[model samples]
Target chain A: MVEFNKISGNVWNIPKSGKMLVPATIYASERLMDTIKQDKTLEQARNVACLKGIQKSAYVMPDAHQGYGFPIGGVAAFDPDEGIISPGGVGYDINCSVRLLKTNLSVEEFMKKRHDLIEALFVNVPSGVGRGGKTRVDRNVIMEVLSKGAQWAVEEGFGRKDDYLRTEENGKMSADPHAVSDRAISRGLPQLGSLGAGNHFLEIQKIDQIYDEKIAKAFGLQDKDNVTVMIHCGSRGLGHQVASDYIKEMEDKYGFKDLPDRELINAPINSDLGQRYYRAMGAGANFAFANKQMITHWVREVFEKIYGSVEIDVVYDVCHNIAKMEKHKIDGKLKQVCVHRKGATRSFGPGREEIPDVYRSVGQPVIIPGSMGTASFVLVGTKTAEEITFGSTAHGAGRVSSRSAALQNISGEHVKNELAKKGIEIKATSWKSIAEEAPEVYKDIDEVVRVSHEVGIGNLVVRVVPLSVMKG
Target chain B: MFCYAPINYINLMPQTENMAEKYKFLQHTADAKFQAFGKTLGEAFANAALAMFAVMFDPADVKPKIEREIKTEGKDEKALLYNWLEELLYLLDTEGFLLSRVKKITIKGKVLEAVVAGDLVANGYKTHGDVKAVTYNEMDIKKEKDKVIAQVVVDI
Candidate 1:
């Protein structure tokens, strides 16, 4: 077992040993630490520290769990001139993200038609395994979506300018369609506006409490009982293909002889192969943005039809899996690094130009989606996070139970009944999917958020409890 | 001169009890993990595909209406296995093809060729979830005197 020394209240450290180039750090409460120790989370974090040019410490967030190469909710920054970029570091679903939509309707008003709204979303939003989306587009149009992202969706009249504006990087990045493969394109083409299965979902929530009134107001959550919607998904099959394609290329080129794990195979950040993968990853990220944009359009249509006239606006959109080149303080000097956050959210604090101009004074809004039939939290980024954790925090309540274990222990009917007891409605493609994503299979969201708050990486602004859910 | 067989010819071969004994699910916290056993490496790889499809839906419900030819090359056995499973996933995503069984497979050196049979995901078929991708995490292919066992973990 890997040993950890307590550094402070919510921080633990594993000093550099053997081939590690830097130390490994984990931010979690003692109770959480017990659960985290149950898996390979610490071992993966230590292996990440062994990567070339990894700066400071390889950090694991509060909701971390054992993943393939990097622990989920893992964060590490590598010097651009010296370090490397790994596809596995970014995750299979590139830019798997969460977007929050706020509505003017109150919870009371929403309650009257909760079932109707959820049913409408279920039928209108294409979901499930290997499902084609409602929007049919050819290869050329898919290329446009790859290059333009949400900008393409807005240009096609899928959403408003403000929607992309409120999104991360304006819902577009520097993407090169040439870097993306035809196979990836074919996989992504039909899945452009779909919410592919396995833990991806759409939830209708009501603001249950306000922790920081000022930040909550700035985020457009002014009062308790305000209705909101959350969309959690990613780039779908296109992104998966990109990751698979690159992993093979990187392995063939670099040959993973020095790496501790084969899945941790990487290419140098400035290398040609590395740059191409980054560009391809950006294209994949754009696909996710365009996807969410079209889904947002359908959601708006659903609301407009049900309520006649309603105001539903984008609050914020954040990527859960991605890599970005940014300047951060290292050794008291600002340096550029490639920050890889797999299953983690960027929590940029105030005064960062990367944030939207309207919210720059406050900070980026961090949306932490919970497991189905649970409470989700909206928090603001902090300077402390920027300084220590590379402006990153936990993505969600990380899974505590395996899929097969949940399949054996829980039934879909039982989960649905439990949610109904809490007055939450659910629509899903299959009962087995519901059982696999049972809330009991995950860590407590409340505890995870509390650690982030106490550690000062993210400050809780508001809490929203689900009223209805549509799972893919 | 290869002639296309009727769909009924393929459907006649239901999954054999011996084929059913080839794979078993293992416990993994975040993803689906399984082990497939066969007398030969090619048979092990074929069983791996069956194990992967079993994660998404009941393979018995699918009929072999369509046949897809898959070709891939890798540096070693591990890479070969990874590429083969990924190709199956790609077919599922692009053509909605669900693997009912591997009809034929031949592996020489690091190159592999296979013909897989399955049905398109259509009306009347129920799917549970999506397998995001195949991972090299804890991926192992072991060859013993009597049998070969391949273990794989898929991200869902």
Candidate 2:
């Protein structure tokens, strides 16, 4: 049995044992801890601690769950010269992220054209399995997208100049197109600007409460009834292909005979293959940024068509899965390390140069999306997070049950009707998806965020509930 | 019954028993996991494809209008299975190919060759979930006296 020692009210530690290089620390409340212990979450966290050059502790967020190699909300930092980089650490959807758009309209005004607006969004955004975008591009444009990210979208008249500025890494990272395979390009070519299915969604939400007026105002969420659009998606097939290719390559070069799990296969951070995978992963992240940028453009058009002239500015876009070279305090000195966050978000606190200039004083805006038809949160990063958790926090209300279990117990029609009664409309390509992603399958969002706030990783700013949802 | 010219194999077994017992989905919290059964290793791999496609859309509902030949290799049987499934996913993303059935499959050493039939997703067939990629997590292939079982878990 895995032994745990309570370090504090919200912190628990699994002491270093066996081949583990460091201890595994988990930030969760008593109630969330009970649910977390029911799975292999603690074991996975321990497995992460065994990786080479892992600094501090392998941290598991309150919303942690069982993932392939790492826990869903796992966070760890590694030394550049001695550490390893795994594709599984970054996850298959390279930069699966969330972008929040604030509109000038209020909830009362949006309710007037609710049905028309929902229908327009459903028609405009190409979603579901393997659905291509309305516009087709050649190989040249795909290359540009892999390099320039959201900048390409803005230049093509899809968005404004300041839009990319508010995104993480300015929505663009230095990427080598040559590192990406032809098959990856082919998969990403047609699917650009489309949202693929399974937990990906586009939600129309209205701010219901504000916890911190200063931070809420900083995030462009000032009023309670102000409407916002949240887009949750990722790099699509291109990212998956990059991850698969690298995992195979890594396994071939350095077999998994010594590793605890095959999915944890990796290469040294400074190795040639590691650098190539990083560049290719950056390209996939750029694809995701471009995809969300195009969708934002269409959402702007839909709003302008229905509500006349209006403003829909980007609040912030946070990457949920990524590995980045960052400077953090290690052993009482500032050092550079490669931080991998799988199913987690960077909660960089105040004065970080990576944060946008407008919110630099308050810190980065971390948007935590709840399950479907539930309350989503807007939180600000904390300095405490940087000190202990490598500036990372939970991603979402992690799943507690399987998709098959949800399918067996719930019906799509019943879920739709229940949401309808609560004034939330949902549209999807198939009923089976709705059933699989039912809210009951997820952990309590309130409890998860509460632990984040209590642990001082992410502080609550504002809360928003979905008005309508478009499932991919 | 559907027939192909390259490999003439008749489905003489009863439809209910053959179709219903080919695959069964297992429980996974955040992804799709399933177990496929067959009389031979090749049949088990083919049924694994059926289980994967079933995660997206019903294979029986997809008409076999297009045929594609797939060839892949691995250092071992586990790697071979991983490559086989990833190849199908590649076709699905690039060509919008929805699997209807596997017409023929032959495994020699660490190499696999198969001819599969399906329809383009653009041909008005409604699809639900997207299987992001295949994983080696909890993947297993077991052989018994009269049957073979191949298990897979895919990231969605």
Candidate 3:
């Protein structure tokens, strides 16, 4: 019933109206239209279009849904010349992402060790609300962590340096720790290595189906039977407090008079307010990278202890929602712009200087994880992705229902028993968690992955089926 | 999915009228009930203290009433609320104390001022997740034309 200015099949535009300087463009499938019909994400899209100096169209991916300001599945690029950066756009879990680690161990091998492996992981990695990690770092060391990210974790005996080479932005962007406030450091003190509650999980999966054998072999995913661990987490309380700290400042200190949602608080890109927020946000990003890296070390240790030895290796770690400076061809001229991807993964195609050398021919490996009971995917970047979506693709199966609604409709205990019936062992702190993350509450991931393929954003590699799951 | 342990009990703090004197024992939903009213935010915070204590036993039952002072400051009103609630929770967690009364309170802008008086005691135990932070998603700051009506979504 609402009017949205049309752009093209790959894009739908929201025209500049009432303080808007740019149009909004949403990239979605025909099926995703209904979800947008029921929410204000479209209006929010238009609102983002209104922000000053928006370099390109304010964009939303297929998984777009209502969030604090810009939709969770949203993206917007701002002019380094004249634009604004908002913490709400990046969300509280700054640099929250998924990292895939492939092991020589296969599905059949995991089946033999499933019960013990799942149980050991559950005990080793602390899960649930207000949980503290088994490791701790002092305030000074944490500051270094804010600046160095996974490199710090590796130097601290967490993982190998090569793990950084395969990660986005080398696991740490240019973060200046002095910009971070002590409060952020304090809030993050206890959350290091903790598997915080909600949406965050560590799933052990096997490569079930290989769609592209040559590309799969090139990316260290050679075996269709090899197992890989996918860790999904974020900056924890540190990032939450960082975003919380900035939102209040943006609301009270810097006021954008006519933005649609007050939650979409922002500041001019070059201003001190903007600079401080970005650096602190980067610190949070570092915290998240370090967190996953530290956990990676423990994961390896646990495997070694149980299996006597592990021939495991890091695959790739990429952020789902983040903002980074990149050079892309616009009007056949290369221009450097800041790309803000909210709940979207970068699918940089071939020959991009930023991508690793091994992936130069096959494009970057994109890991798409479904729920514990559903099938996950491994996809490769494509040239079509670079031309159409700024080299981005859908992150995962977007939520189809609210948490409360899910609780009312499904029983956690029942879902657990059902998954067990499927031979997937579930280890969690509480059944409430199992209910909250029921696979049914999310969009059909297979459909989502299918759309991405049809759209030519990315091509499917292999399907990874779960043998066991662990959640916070 | 966000989940909470449903509240299944009848308990409220006693109240009196005349602004400072008027307070009520109220349950907002399946998870939370508090003595939420005030001549000001500080008074309302004080009542919240009483409500926390009442969750365990009759507020009237705690004998030899003792007193303590708690102060917390945050970047904004919402953060202020979190720290304020957390301070009270720390007392309950560390000191095993439940507050029963408030002698005085004041709220000037974001600065919440209150003097909470109570005793160190135990009440009926219920398995509860320590409240982490308050959320702003469904936060309510009701105002009837000009009068301010207080309500908020405290993330537990």
Query: Candidate 3 lDDT, tens digit per residue, A279-328?
Result: 88888898889888888888998888777678777788888868777776
lDDT of 1 at B126: 79
* Candidate 1 wrongly placed segments (more than 4 Å): B1-20
Q: Write the per-residue lDDT of candidate 2 for residues A1-472, one digit (tens) a residue.
A: 5789899999999999998999999999999899899888899899999999999999999999889998799999999999999999999999999999999988899999988998999899899887888879988999999999999999999999788999999999889878999999999988999988999999999999899998999888987777999999999999999999999999999999887778999999999999999899999999999999999999999998888887999999999999999999998999999999999999999999999999999999999999998899999999999998999999999999988888889998999999999999999888888888889999999999999999999999999999999997
lDDT of 3 at A414: 94
Off by over 4 Å in 3: A5-11, B1-106, B113-140, B145-156
Task: Put down candidate 2 lDDT per residue, B1-156, tens digits, no spaces.
Answer: 111222234244455665448889988878889998877778788889999998989998999999999999988888999999999999998888999998998888878889999999899988887899999988899988757799999998
Restricting to chain A, the TM-score for each candidate equals 0.99, 0.99, 0.96
Tell me the docking grade of candidate 3. incorrect
DockQ of candidate 3 relative to the true structure:
0.11
Tell me the tens digit of each residue's lDDT in model 1 across A1-472. 8988999989999999999999999999999999999999999999999998999999999999999998899999999989999998999999999999999888898999988998899889999887879888999999999999999999999989999999998999898988999999989988989988899999999999999999998999987767899999999999999999999899989897787778898999999999999999999999999999999999999998887788989999999999999999999999999999999999999999999998999999999999999999999999999998999999999999888899899999999999999999999989999999999999999999999999999999999999999998
Measured against the native two-chain assembly using Cα atoms, what DockQ does each of the candidate structures obtain, in the order listed? 0.72, 0.74, 0.11
Reference-based lDDT, each prediction: 0.91, 0.91, 0.70
* Chain A superposition TM-score, candidate 2: 0.99
